[model samples]
Target: MATKRNVSSTKEEGPVIDEAIERNWEIPDFTIKEIRDAIPAHCFRRDTFRSFTYVFHDVAIILALGYAATYIDHLPSAPLRLALWSFYWIAQGVVGTGVWVIGHECGHQAFSPSKAINNGVGMVLHSLLLVPYHSWRFSHSRHHKATGHMTKDQVFVPHTRKALGLPAREVDPEGDGPHSALEESPIAMLYNMVMMFVFGWPLYLFTNVTGQDYPGWASHFNPYCDIFDSNQVSEVYQSVAGLLATIGLLTYCGQVFGSLAMIKFYVIPYLFVNFWLVLITYLQHTDPTLPHYRENVWNFQRGAALTIDRSYGFILDYFHHHISDTHVAHHFFSTMPHYHAEEATVHIKKALGKHYKFDPTPIPQALIKSWKTCRFVEDEGDVVFFKN
Candidate 1:
């Protein structure tokens, strides 16, 4: 593993940079075992029954919501009916996201002790959400293994300055640097956010958008895509089949019960589910204060600590299974159940000290700030910070 060097003077190879930037960006010296040792042993245990209970709970709420939504057509006023249907979409979407979270837990093998149970449940839930389960699961494991690696990290890899056509760092000052006005404009920011939250998930699935660049065509649905190994092709094909089955089911429902009804109940809510999925993940990894490391400075422990945990409030946190607030713990120990993550996180914070990152900024504000400022990273640093 490489260690941080204290450079006080400007070197011929690079520009003069701030000492504080280098100081703050030093690679952590603590080992992963030290952090794991801080958490109680029981926190690592997965309860099969407890995990199934959450699955049932989410499913029950989804069915009840679907049943309750049946009455919207009976409302006397069109405006009233539309309002109620809108509410159902947002409410069901939130609950549906909870289901997605559970599926995600299954992908991480944190839902149950048995791999059979975890994969079986995960396939069903993820297929319902139109996700390729095994494909995402395999790639997500890679993400956990290399969370902040500039090239190896699976998702939300920052654009390097060279990629964005920005000038060399030596040409610009350390603190005051050139920023693209149009890219940072309010209108541009809003447009980018809308595109990201609305279509980001689908784009990522189909085209590997916002993911590490791979040779040739890359897609979650493509078994032969560079994202998966030859040995994993069978599982990727299984995920594709599951998605096809779900699509066929949805199509049958559309034929049986008018396309408009299907749109109102399923399609809209599904989009919102995608929105929440993208929002949660984007905010977790992308932040101004967070550092992305070149291969030399990157290691599993440092890469894992690159993530930030943010509070989405009690309601969102609960329904979302605390994926946002307890993310640091999740990265450190991917197999730890979500039920015990909050407890694990408390001990992790103590163990990590200043290396632990938790951003308490309200979700909306944090979303905007990250979008505006975290446009790209310098192409030439061992440890790089995002720059506008």
Candidate 2:
């Protein structure tokens, strides 16, 4: 409801680097030299394609899982069928995380050496899940650039008391306040769901509702928008084509397996796939402790700089790198592939120290902790960056 503008000046903010560790934060000339040394030494550089081996393997695994699901009736007992169904849903969610990563790579222009390839790959993967690739890529890149900044940061930034105004009711940022209003009201929930990704992608394509208010070519699914600043309509076409192809496949699967069987094997897994997507993305940005900037205090750097790195530990290491686990590093150096993120976090932590925060306890504890202590509005005056 507040129509404030961003008025914070970079001059008032002082230097970009913290003075105490500014000298130490340097890539250490030796390390920079060492990092540069490997550029040409390795057969693949950042832009170079790494054989597409993972893509093939991932696709093959998905296919194999699909096949297994299709034949779940072949299982000898009820328990086996139940086990297979459980495996299918969880595996789909996990694999779907990879799929989102590939789309994210498209956002970074890292999925393949060519923009053409990245767009093609990104659109297909994202579209199959009903996301609009260009819409997300545009805002997402801005999110990376402005991770922890108080005001301009995208996704979920914690709101300060001044931002909320003294008269406003204090409520949970993730649930009662923003969420309840968004969910319980059709219009509000429509906006929330759209902004939050349930229906955000397509609406971005068709409406350009929640993202940065780029006036000109922003809403259309066309290539004119700045987000499409990376790829072309060919990528959009691929997404459409993927839908068509999937429709054909679904039709065939249904005909051969019958609607109920297909529902058990395919539709259920497909629906469940995005549930984790919603949950992962929701928890990543929406902690009550996280800050969202009011327009005046919101600066690009401050908003973007605010994020918490979550520890999903071994599961994230073995699989979901693109999820919330390595999120802090991802926010800082987004162009780096998820594959390189875990390694980079070590260097980053040594440099960032307290600036880097990790919720080491199981997410369940974090969730409950967040619900209780994180309630209500934090004063911008008192909000502490992990460094303090």
User: Highest lDDT, which number?
Assistant: 1
- Worst window of 10 by summed lDDT in candidate 1: 8-17
lDDT for each residue of candidate 2 in 1-388, tens digit (9 for 90 to 100)? 1211223224345323321132232211223333323333222235435525556666787888878676887878999888878888778767766766767777787655677787777777776665666666766766676654444444444444444443322353442343233234457534644454444334445665434445576654555665455555665555446666777877898998798877776666565555556555556665644544444344443443355677666765455554576666666556666666666666656655555566665776765445334423434221222110
Off by over 4 Å in 1: 1-23, 172-178
Whole-model lDDT, model 1? 0.88
lDDT of 1 by residue, 1-388 (tens): 3333433222333422342266555558789999989999999999999999999998999999999999999989999998999899998999999999999999999999999999999999999999999999999998999999888999999998778776666675533243767777788878988998889999999999989999888999888978999999999999999999999999999999989989998999999999999999999999988878766567899889999999988988999899999999999999999999999999999999998999989888998888878888766556778877
* Deviation from truth (RMSD, Å), model 1: 3.2
TM-score of 2: 0.67
Task: Tell me the deviation in Å of residue 36 in model 1.
Answer: 0.9
Query: All candidates' TM-scores?
Result: 0.93, 0.67
